[model samples]
Target chain A: MKKYNNIADKLVKSSIANPERIYNYLLYISAAFFSVLIIFPFYFLFVVSITPQHGLAEVRYLPTGFQWENYIDTLEIVPLHQYILNSIIIATITTVFVLIVASLAGYVFGRFKFKGRGVLLVAFLIITYFPGTTYIIPLFRLFTGNISLFGLATPDLYGTPWPVVLPLAGITLPLATFILTVFYSRIPDGLEDAARIEGCTRIGALFRVIVPLSAPAVATVGILTFILVYNEFFFSFLLTDSSYNNWAPLVHGIQMYEVTTVRGSPYHLMAAGSILGLIPVTVLVFLGQKKIVSGLTAGALKE
Target chain B: MGDVILENIVKQYEDVTAVENINLNIKDGEFICLVGPSGCGKSTTLETIAGLTKPTSGEITVADREVTYLPPKDRQIAMVFQNIALFPHMNVHDNISFGLRLRNFDSKEVKKRVENAAEILQIKEILDRMPDELSGGQQQRVAIGRAIVRDPEVFLMDEPLANLDAKLRVHMRTELQRLHKELGTTIIYVTHDQAEAMTMADRIAVLNKGELQQIAPPLKCYNEPANQFVASFIGSPSMNFIEGKIRSGGFESTHINVDINIGNYDDLSIGDPITLGVRPEDVYPKSNSPEIQSQSDPIDAQVDVLEPMGDEIFVYLRLNVGAEDGPTVTETSSADQLLMSVDPDSDVSTKDNIELVIDREKLHLFESGNGNAITHGIGEQTALNQNR
Candidate 1:
C-alpha cells in the first residue's frame, strides 16, 4: 500500500509538471482553424474584385493581375455610388427607427410585470421566427392600396423610401428588442427604484438611469440592426423596382450586376460591389466592437 | 421631520402574502434595524415605507403626511440596495448629483451638494472614478453618499453591507453608526444578520414569516425575546431548548434532572409540558470550583464536542448516564443535550464524564405546544454581565 501511494503521488507530481499541455495544443489548433475559416471569404471577395476581367477565364484562387478599372466600371453598370448612398440612408434611418421602438418596447417588456407580458413578448418572438418574405405580398398591398390600413388618402408607397424603411425596421425590431430586453432585465430594477426615490419620475428614471447604464446593449442592438439592414437583399430586391433605383440598397444594386453566361461570371464587378457594400458595416463594427462584445455577453458575468 | 407610521399595512400578491398587517411607528431620527430571515417581508415592509411599493390595505404617514398612495418621488426618501445599484455608466460625482440635477437644481448647487457629500463619505479623490473602478466598500460608500446628498426625511437601506468582506462590514457598521449620529436622519435598515442588528440599531424590529415579532432596544430584544423565533434568531450559538414538563414545583427535562424552582404563572399549571430554554453561558461544568457550583444538584453529562472561539469555549454535553427508573421522562430523542460556554483556559476534553449545574435564575420555561414563555427572565442584569 505504501509503494502504491508513492507511485500515485509521483504520477500526480509528474502530471502537474506539464499542466494542460494537451488542452493548450487543442485550443491553438481550433483557434487557427476558426481564424482561417472566417478570413477566407473576405480574402476570396478581395481577390475576385481586383482580378483582371480577362484573367477570370483562368482557374485560380489568387488574382493574376489587377484590373483597377473594374472598380470604376462597376459603378457605371449599376449607378453604384447612388446605390451605396441609398443603402447607407436606408440602413441608417431603419436602424434609428428600430432602436427607438425596440428600446421602449424592450424596457416595457423587461421591467414591467403586467398581465399578458410573457404572451406579448412571445408573440413578438414569433414574428421573428417567421421568415420576413412570407408576408411580402400583403405588406406591399397594404402600403400601395388606395384604401389603406394605415389610414392614408390614396397612398402608393412602392416608389418611396417608406416602403423599404418600414419593412426593414419591422424585420430588425424583433431581434433588437430581444437583445435589449435581455440586457435590460439583467440590470436590477433596484437601480431604477433608487432613481425614483431620488425624485425622478418613472419615465425620467427610465431615460436617465436605465438608458445610460444600457450603453453596451444599445451598441449591440445598433450594430446588429445596421449590419442586417445594410446587407438586406431579399426585401430590398422584392419591395422596390428598378425605376426607383435611387432608393435601392447596395445589396439590391450588387444583385443587378450578376450575369451567369456560358463564358463565366462577372466575379470581378460583383465582388467590387460587394466590398463597397461591406465598408460601412466594417467601419461601424470596428468603432463599436468593444461595446458589442460586452453587450452580447452581459448577463453571463454575474458580478 | 421623519416620524413614520404604518397602520395595518397588508400586502398580498395573487399567490402569496408578502406582508400581513404590519403596524410599526418609527420615531423621528431613530435608527431602526429590521432583522429577519429571507422571505420574512422585512424588505417588503421597508419598501412599502419608502413608497416604492404600495401596500394592499394600509395607511402610511411619513413626517405626518399621508404618503400611502403617493409615488416614491413624491415621498421624501432615499434608499441603498444590497447589490449597491450605483449606475455603472456614471462616475461617483454624477451618481451623487443625479437626483439634484433631475429636480433641476442649478449646476452650482448640484456641485456644492455633490462635493459636500463627497467630503462626508471621504471619497472626494475618487469623484471622477466610475462605479466599476471602485472597490466594494468604496462603491457602497458612494451609494450612501448618493442617498445622503438628497437629504431626504428617511433613508431606507436594504442590506447595504451584506456584500463586503467581514472586516470591511464591521468597519462600515461603525461608520454607519457615526453617520447616523452626525446626520440625525430616520433610517430603516434591513438585514438578515442579527449581529448587525445587535451592534448598530438603536432599536431592532424582529420579524418572522411576514409578521412583526418584536421591536425594542437591542438588549431588550436580546434579553427578553418575545417568542421562540426571536429567542432563537437573536443570539449566536442560539439558546438551547429542552422539552419536558412542569411537575411538583420545578422544571423538568426528560433526559436529565437538574431541579429548578419555577414560580407560579397565570396560565401554567401542574403536569403541563414545557420547553426548558437556557443560554450556553448559563450552563457551567461542576467541579470543586466554588464560582460554578450553584443551588442545583450536579447532573452528570458526557462532553460530546468542544468549540473554542478565542476567549470562550462552547462545551456540548449530552446526558450519557444509563436510563433511570422514572419513566425515561416520556421521550429519549437524540437532541437531548446541554451546551455550556466556558473559559477557553479551562481543562476539558471530549468524551469525559463531567458533572454540570445550571443557573436556576437564568432558566427559561416555554409552553411546549405554542412555544410561549411560561416564565422568562427580563435580562436586565444577566449572569454574563456579572461574569464579565
Candidate 2:
C-alpha cells in the first residue's frame, strides 16, 4: 500500500509539474464539445436528407430508412441541376468581378495618400452597415424597368441572373475591399520600392511583387465572396422569377420544395437539395483551407 | 562612368523641409556616405539622387544624363533598403535577377548575372533558399546581390546593415568595403553611425536639420569640423563643450573654475563670447603625460565615475569640486562635467581628486552665437583661422 501511494504521488507530481498534460485533456474535451455543437446540425441534415419523406416527423436521431432516391426525386421535382449551374456561373462572375475591382481599389486605398481618402474609406465602411433588404425594393424596381436613372429607363433584368448577380456583387464588394486593403497595407513599403528600383514600373511592381505576396489574402477574399454569393437566398428569391430558366440559384430551387405533397411538406427533399447545394463551396473551402486560415490569422496579428 | 551631381536639391513636404538646397558632386567610383542623426534628411537626399523621391527644385544628373523628373527605373540606379527588402516570395536567384528579367534580358545573361552577383556577395549557397529561410546577415547580402546584379551606373544603400547584430554589422562593413573595391561603382551609403561613415566612406556628408553641415573626407571632418555640430556628431564620446567668454589673456568660464590660453584669435575680439571644444581623448592627466606640448594650465577636478572599456578607461571628472557643499552632479545636466579618456593601464578610481589639462594643440573654438567653427588647433599662433 505504501508503494502504491508512492506511485500515485509520483504521477500527481509529474502531472503537476507539466501542466501541459491537463491542458491537453481540456483542449481535447472542449474541441470535441465544440465540434459536436458545430457538426450536429450538418449530421441531422444528412440524416433527414436520407430519410424517407414520411419519416421526417418521427422522433429519431437516426434515419428510419435510407432513401437515396430522395436526391433524384428532388432533382425531378425542381430543376436543381440547372439552378446549381446558374449559381456556379453567377458566383464565378461575381467573385472574379469583386476580386478585380476590390484588389485595385484596395491597392489605391492601401498605398497612396490623397485628400478625402479617409472619408471615402469610411463611406465604404458605412455601406456595409445597412442590411441588403433596405435596398432590395428599389433594386427590384430598378431591375424591372420601373425605376429610371437620369431620365433614362432602366434595363429590364428581372427574369435574368444580372439582377441577382449585380446586387450580390455590390453588397459583398465593400467587405472584400476592406479585407484586401488591410492586407495590402500590412506589406512593407520597402518591397515596392525595391521593385521600382529594380526596373519595374508601378503597375509591374503591383503584379510581380504585390499581387504574388497577397496570394493568401486574395484567396481569402475570393473564397469569402464565392461562398457568400453561392449560398445567398434573399437576392435570388426576390430578383428572379420562380423558374430555373430565369436563372434562379440553388437556394431558390431548394425553397420550392416547401410545396405540399401527398404526405406533407417535402422537407426531406429540401434537406437533400440543401446537401447537394453545399458541394461546390465545401470543395472550395477545403482546397483553399490553408490560405484562408493563414490569411485570417495574419490579418489579426499586428506586424 | 557613373558620376552623380545634384544641383540645388530641395524637397519641401508642405509644412516641413526634408532637405534644402543640397548640392553633391559624387565622383565616379567614389564611396560617399551620408551620415547624420535620425530625421536629418540623409535618406531624403539619397532618395532624390536615386529618383525615388523627386526634388521640388533640382537637377540630378547620373552618368551625364539629367534624371531629375525621371522614375527610379529610368535613373540607371539600384538601391538596398535598410530593412533588407528581399522579395519574400522569391528565392535568392530570382530576387537577384529581378531587374535583369524585368528588362527582358535573355535567360543566359540573367542567370550569368545572378550567379556572378551571388559569387560577389558570397551568397551562392543561398541562391535556392527563400528570404525567410536565411538569417538577417544572409538576407542583407541577398539585398546587396540584388543591387549588384542590376549593374546600374550607381548604387544606393540606405543603412543596409542597420538590422544586423553588432558582430554581423562589423563583418558586413568589411564585406561592403571589399565589394566597393571590386566593383568600383559610384556607391552612396546612408547611415547614422559615425563609425560606419568613418570606416567605409571616401567622403562623408554630414547633415543636420535638413541642411548640409559639412561634406569632406572622413579624417578632415574629424580633425577640422565645419561647425560645432559636426565636432560633436563625428567623434565617439563626443567633444566636450564649455561656454565661456574670450578675455584679454585667454578663455574663461562662468559656471566652472577653468581658464585656458587659446592663443590670440585674430577673428575673435576681446570680451566676445566663444565656446571651447575639446575631445575626450585630448584631455590628459597632467603628471602622467609630459610629451603633450602646448598644454593648458592644470585645473583641479574630482573623478566622479570610471568606466573601463577594455582598451581605454573613460573618466568622468567633475569641475569645481573642492568643497563638500559644492554643486552636486545632476542627471539632467552635463555642463560642469568633463569626460576624459585615459590609458586602460592607468590607475584611476571614483572620488579621487586629480588635475586635468587639455591639449591646446587639439583645441577647437567656435562662435557661441552661430555655432560655427572659428578655428581648430587654436594653441599655435600660425594656425589657420576663419571668421564666418
Candidate 3:
C-alpha cells in the first residue's frame, strides 16, 4: 500500500509541475477544431465571391484569385447603406424603449408588494408566450386600414421601419422586464434598509442605493437587450419591402439572389457581409465579456 | 439625550399582534434593554419608538413631543440594526456623515463630525475604506459611528451585538456600555440574550408573547421576579421550580415536606398546590450540614446527572415521590428531578442518592394556578421602587 501510495504521489507531482503546458496543448487542439468548423465555410464563400464569375464553378477550398470589384457590384445592386441605417435605427429605438419601460415595470414588480402584482406578472408571461403568428393577420389588416388614433394616423407601415421597430419593441418588453426583475430581486435587502436609515425616502432609496448596487444587473440587461434587438429577424423580414432593406432582410436578400441566376452564388460578398454584421456584436461581447459570463453563470452557481 | 414614553402602544398585523398595549416610561440618558425570546415584541417596540413603525393605536412622546405619526427621519433618532446596514459603496467617512450631508451640513462640518466619530471609534485609519472591506466587528463599529455622528435624541439598537463571535460580543457589550455613558444618549436596545441585558441595562424590560412581563434593575429582577416567567428567563442554569402544597405554617409534598416560618401566609389553607423556586446557588452541598432547627425541611434526592463546571457541579437530582395529588409538574421539572449547584470538589456522581437540605428562609412560594409569588418582601420608599 505504501509503495502504491508513493507511485500515486509521484504521478500527481509531475502532473502539477506541467499543468500550464498541458492546459495550453489541450486549448490549442480545441481552438483548431472549432476554427475549422466555423472559418471553413466563410473561406469557401470568399473563394466563391471573389473568383471571376466564370471561375465560380471551379472553386475549391482555396481561392483561385481575388475579385474585389464584386463588392461594388453587389452594393450597386442592393441598398446596402439604407439597410444598415434602417437596422441601426430600428435596433437603437427598440433597445432604448424596451430598457426604459422594462426597468420601471421591473422595479415595481421586484420591490413592491401590491394587489395583482403576481397576476400582472403572469399576464406579462402569457403575453410573451402568445404566438406572434396569431397577430400577423390583425396587424396586416391594421396596416391596410391605416389605423389612426385621436389625431396621429398610421402611415403605410408595411414598407416602413415603424412596424418592425414598434412590434419588436413590444415583444422585447416582457423579456427585458423579466430579466431585470430577476436582477433587481438579487440585490440585497440590507442595502435598501441601510439607505432608509441614512435618511433616504422610498424613491431616494430606489434611485440612490438599489440602482447603484444593481449595476452589474443593469449591465447584464443592457447587453442582452442590445443583442436581442440587433438580431431580431422575423418582424424585420416580414414587415419591410426590398426597397427598405434592414439587416435581417439583407441576409435574406443575399441568400435569395445567391441561389438564383440573377446573382448566381455571390458567396464571397455574403461571407464579407456576415463578417461585417458580426463586428458590432463581437465588439460588444468583448467589452462586457466578464459581466456576461458572470451574469450567465450566477444563475447556475450560488455563493 | 431624550426621555421616551409609550402609552398604550399596540402593533397588530393581519392575524397576529406583535406588541399589545405596551406602556413604558424611559427616562433621559438611561440605557434600557428590552430582552425576550423571538416574537416577544421587544424589537417591534424599539422600532415603534424610533418612528420606523406606525403603531396601530398609541401615543409616543420623545423629548416630550408627540411623534407617533412622524417619519423615522424626522424623529431625530438613529438606529443600529443586527445586520450592520452600512452602505457598501460609500467609504466609512461618507457613511458616518451621510445624515449630516443629507441635512445639508457644510463640507467642513461634515468632515469635522465624520473625523470626530471616526476618531472616537478608532476607525480613522479606515475612513476611506468601504463597508465590505472591513471585518464584522469593524462594520459594527462603523454602524454605531454612523448613528453617533447624527447625534440623534435616542439611539435605538436592535440586537447590534448578535452578529459577532462570542469573544467579540463580550468585548462589544462593554464598549456599548462605555459609549452609552460617554455619549449620555437615551438608548433602547433590544436583545434576546439575558447576559447582554444584565450587563448593560440601567433597567431591563422583560417581555413574553407581546406583553411586558416586568421592568426593573437587573439585580432586582433577578432577586425578586414579579412572575415565574421573569424568574425562569433571567438566570443562567435557570431557577429550579419544585411542586408542593402550601399549607398552614409551611409547604408540603410527597417526596418531602418543609415547614417554613414565613412571616405572612399564616392563613393560607392546606392542600393548596404551589411551586417553590430556588436558585442553584441557594442549594448547597450537604457536607456543611448545619444544625437544623425544628422549622427546616430536609428533602433527600438521588443524583441523576453530574455536571462539573469548574466552580461547582450542577447536580441533577430526582426525588422519590408518588401520590394521587402528586403535583403534575411539566417536563421543565420532570419527575422530581432537580438541578442543584454543589461544591465542585464534592465526590458526587450519577446513581448516588444524596440527602439535601433546603434553607426555608430563602425559599420562594408561588401559587401554581397563576404563578405569582404568594409572599412579599420588604421594600424602601423610592420614586422608581415597586410596591411589595
Question: What tens digits encode model 3's per-residue C-alpha lDDT throughout A159-189?
Answer: 7667777777777788778877877676666
Which residue ranges in model 1 land beyond 4 Å of their true spot?
A1-83, A108-123, A129-133, A146-154, A188-217, A232-278, A290-303, B51-53, B69-71, B248-250, B255-264, B284-304, B319-335, B343-361, B378-388
Could you give the DockQ of candidate 1?
0.30
lDDT of 2: 0.86
In model 2, pairs of residues that clash are: none
Interface RMSD values, listed in order for every candidate? 4.0, 5.0, 6.5
Candidate 3: segments with Cα more than 4 A from true spot: A1-97, A100-120, A137-166, A211-214, A233-279, A290-303, B47-56, B59-72, B89-107, B130-133, B256-271, B285-296, B302-304, B321-335, B342-362, B376-388
Docking class of 3: incorrect
Error of 3 at B353 (Å): 6.2
Whole-model lDDT per candidate: 0.80, 0.86, 0.75
Best candidate (score: DockQ): 2
Best by lDDT: 2
Error of 1 at A127 (Å): 3.2
Worst 10 residues of 3 chain B by lDDT: B379-388
TM-score of chain B of each: 0.92, 0.95, 0.90
